[model samples]
Target: MKAVVIEQFVSNFEDLKPRDAPLPSSKKSSDIQIKVTHASLTHVDMLYAQGLHQNNKRHVKPPFVLGTEFAGIVISSPSNKFAPGDRVFGGGLGSYAESICVDEGIVRRVPGLWSNAEACAVGVSGAVSYGSLISVARLKRGETVLVLGASGGLGVMAIQIAKAVGAKVIALVGDKEKSRIMKELGADEAVSYRQRNWEEEVRALTDDGEGVHVVYDAIGAIESALKCLRYRGRIVIVGFAARGGKMEEVRANRILLKSAMVHGYRYGEDGRRDPRRTEEVWSGFLNLVEAGGIRPIIFQGNYMGLESIPRAFGDLKMHKVWGRAVLRINEDVEATKEAARL
Candidate 1:
């Protein structure tokens, strides 16, 4: 099988290459093998290739596949709950391959409403957005919520999820175009963070200029988002897309003054530690999708053969696209079979 293998730590994306590798072996009765139809790229994938993640420094040596999420058809199932042709969506490391073997505990059956592309894009972003707003943030109806970095995959989902939870959502983007996109995704108002006094604009849009009750900061621009929070508000740190490495310095007096709480969220860790909680969050997200309350935003990439994957990574780093960028693998696999056939 053809796969994108990270053979070395490359400073440039183009240095990564596609290589022919053996297909993964099927697991015993406790595991299942999926024919990967689509795999999507995230910033974390780039970081992993560059040896930025903690494990990459020690483990993740040469000749390892690199990817975290994919949607596919079941070729073989060891459990009674799944059949050979069942469509499923799930997440796993080293998914940039033709097939993957995963524990049945981590995979979820898609609900026949989404496409393989949508399912692949929704993996970590959808779960994190839904879980942070509905669970960690404990967002209340009629409350105001702010989504930082509202144009990215997780940010876009956060905007929609906050609205689905009955909160007045304020999406913070970097420019007017992204602001418009956020508004279309159900944000009550969108603010451009590039503009001066954007924090004041966020405050003005909420009730009585008191700021928002919950702030979802995926950009890691925590100081600005923190300053825009209301008294006794909660801030959910989803990711550090904007600022990486080293913690930001936040004043303790400010936390004391506002009586605010800061929470760090890592959906992957949570899912690995507590599978039931992960399933519950996924159920809620799918229910909202089925109810027409939220929709996945996808950015399509050209269908390239398995050998062209290194270029896809380059395109991602160049900011040549937006939303979720997916690669079609296994031309024999139907694009609709993974998510739409559920």
Candidate 2:
């Protein structure tokens, strides 16, 4: 099998290269063997490659697979949750190759309405958004939410999830184009942070400029978003897209005056802490996708094969990716269907 491997942490993404590797097989009866069709390269993947990821579940020191989330056809399943022909998608190791072995508990079935690429794109983003907003943040129905960096995968998921539960969403992005896309995703209003007085603009969008009930701060915009919160509103710090999550100072009086709640959320770490709850959230999110309640946006510009990892990584690091990016790990997902029919 051909797989993407990183021998050592390097400053350059081009340092990652494809190598002919031995095929992987399931070591446990509860494991799933999948023939991978598509995989997603997240911003976290970029951060991990650069050794910027601080709270990663695993250290990933060197000589490991370079990718995680994947959509694939099951080759074997020893549990009742899936069968050999089930089309599934989820996050796990060994997805940078044609075949992968993962614990059955981590993978989930793909919705009939979604393509394998879309399934691959949603695993991390959907898990993170739904987990942070619903499970961790406990956002209630009819609440107003401001989703920072609303154009990226996590941000887009946050917008859709907020809308599904009847919450009004004010989407924030770094540019006008993302703002447009956010509006198309059912955001009540979308604004670019680059625009002057954007935080005030966000406030003006609310009734009496009282700010939103909840601020889903995935871009680490803690300080500015503080001004965009209503009294006693909650803010969940979900992502660190700014400055590699460097510690920044915040006015204690702002949070004090508003009587707001501030919390940090990392989906993977949360899952590690509580697997059963994470599974339930993942299942519910896929159900939302099946019912036409949410749409996972994929980046058309960065959709490429495994051969394009370098280019895609470069684009991600430079903040050129506008939405979720996917890599088609295999060209023959339809071929898996043919086998299923037989």
Candidate 3:
């Protein structure tokens, strides 16, 4: 088999390389062998590659295949839920390879409306957006919501998800073009955080100028998020992707005064701890995708195969990708199966 291998913990994304690897076979009765067609190539994959993510670092370590989200055809299944040739998508370890064996519980059939790339495009990020918006915030129809870092994968997904529920969305980005993209993606208003009064602008855009009902914050700008939230508003902290370790303080008094709720969400972690909730969140996200409430914003150049995976990491780190990036591991996958003799 062939894969993108991280041979050691490194400071550079260039350390990732295409290499020969042993094929993975099913070890458990619940596992299924998948012929990988596409895999997610995102900042998180970069983090995993460099051993920056704690759990991925602990489990994957060095000399490991690098990937989580993937879409593929089933080469074999131990259970009746999926048969050979069924198209499935989900998160799994070592999915960067031409093929991988994963527990069937982690994967689900791709909806008929979506393509292989489109199905995996939303994989982990879409679930996180769903958990943050619906599970944590309990966002309601007609409510006003604000999404920070609205140009990234999670933010773009958040914008569409908020709009799907009939909520007016205010998307916050770092530049004018990102703001324009957010508006095109269905955000009712877009604000540039580069502006001096961006928080105030967010407040002004909401109904009656009081504040927004929910804040889906992906950039970890906790201070600014607190400023624009309405009385009794909920703030769902998605991540600290802004690259700063030091964050502005959150005043307990502010929360007390406004009756605010601050939630720190990590969908991946939550799913690990609670399988049922994980199932619910993933299914709900796929249903929404099938219903056309949202779609993956994939780019062709970013879908370069395993050979250019190192470039994928570079593209993400350099901030060159607009939305979630998906890499086609083996578009024709038949060659992969032939090589593996599965």
| TM-score versus the correct structure, for each prediction | 0.91, 0.92, 0.89
Tens digit of lDDT per residue, candidate 1, span 185-282? 78899888878989999999988999899999987877887789999999999887655333578777888888999888888789879878888898
Better of 1 and 3 by TM-score: 1
Give candidate 1 regions above 4 Å deviation.
26-29, 55-63, 244-247, 307-311, 318-320, 335-342
| 1 versus 2: better TM-score goes to | 2
On lDDT, who's better, 1 or 2?
Answer: 2
Best by lDDT: 3
Tens-digit lDDT track of model 3 for 8-121: 766766666778888897788898999999998866667677666656536767777888889999988887899887888988878888998999988888777777888787
- Model 3 spans > 4 angstroms off: 244-254, 334-342
- Each prediction's whole-model lDDT (CA): 0.79, 0.81, 0.81
Candidate 2 structure lDDT:
0.81
Model 3: which ten-residue window has the lowest total lDDT?
Answer: 333-342
Candidate 2 stretches greater than 4 Å from native: 25-29, 56-58, 245-251, 338-342
lDDT at position 92, candidate 3: 84
Clashes of each: 0, 0, 0
Give the Cα RMSD of candidate 3: 3.4
